[model samples]
Target: MNHASAFDMDAFRPHDHGRCRRAARAAAERECQARGLRLTPARAFVLDALLESHRAMTAYELLDRLREAGLGKQPPIVYRALDFLVANGFAHRVERLGAFVGCVHGADDHRAAFLVCRSCRQVAEAVLEAPPAALTAQAEATGFAVERVTVEAEGLCERCRADA
Candidate 1:
C-alpha cells in the first residue's frame, strides 16, 4: 500500500500498474486531440512518470528521470513540461508539497479534493459533491472570484494508520 508504488484505479490499491499508466497516457492523448493540442514528448514523459506513482514528486526528482531517459537534463525543461501539464489540466500541483501528480481520474480542472497522507506523502484524489459550506460562504461574503477549488486534507491513510 505504498503510495510510491503502483496505484490501483478502482480499489485504490496496487494492481495493473502498467495498464493504469497506459490508460492515463491514452486519456491525455485523447484530451489533447479533442482540444486540438499536442502532448509533446517531454510533457508525456513527465506525465507518465507521475502516473507511475501516486506519491507527489518534486521537479528535481522528475528531472532526474528525464535525464536518465535522455529527455532533457535542464531544470527549465522539466519545469516547462510541468507548466504545460498543469496548465492543460493533465496534472495538478500539490501546493503543500510543491510537487506534481498526474490526473488519472479525469481532466484536472474538475473540482476535486486531495487526500494527502501525512505519513507517506501519497496523494489520493477525490471528487467533492460540492464546495465546502464555509468556503462558499466566505467567498460570497468577500465577492471573491473562485476559478478552481481543491481541498487538501492531511491525515494517514489506512495503511499508514495501521502501521502506526
Candidate 2:
C-alpha cells in the first residue's frame, strides 16, 4: 500500500469523530445548495462513507460498503461517485495512499496539508493561510510561479506507537 510521509502522519488521530462527520456533511450540503450542485444519492453515500471513518479508503473498499448498502456493487458506480465528490471539493484524494478522505473544511480548494498515520492510514487535514515566505521567495527568485503545494507527513499514531 502507498504510505504518506512522516510529516503527514501527525495529523490523523482520535478526536470528536461523530461531530466532525456530521459537521462535514452539513457543510457539504449547504455548499452544494449554494453552488447549484446536487448532492445526488451516489455522491452522498460516498461522502458519508468517507466521513464515517478517519481512515483513507481505497476505491475498492468503498465499493464494498456501497455493495453492502445496496447502492451499487459495480466498480464504476463507486468510481463515478468518488470522482464527483473529489471534483466538487467535498473530498480529497490522498495521492500517497491512492485513497480518498472527506474534506473537513468546506468545498474550498485551499492549500491543505495532511498528517497520516502509517499503521491505520487515517488522515487529518489542515489549511495553510499562506505559503511559507522562504519558499515563495525562492520560487520568485527562480522566476517560477508557485501554483499548488501538497505537504504530507506520515508516522505511527499514538495508539499504534503505544501498541509497539
Regions more than 4 Å wrong, model 2: 1-13
lDDT of 1: 0.77
Range of the 10 consecutive residues with the lowest summed lDDT in candidate 2:
1-10
Looking at candidate 1, what is the lDDT of residue 2? Answer: 19
Model 1: lDDT of residue 32: 90
Per-model TM values vs. the true structure:
0.83, 0.83
Count clashes in each candidate, considering only residues at least 3 apart in sequence or on different chains. 0, 13
Worst 10 residues of 1 by lDDT: 1-10
Query: What tens digits encode model 1's per-residue C-alpha lDDT throughout 48-118?
Result: 89988788899999999999999889999999999998888788888778888887766645555677777
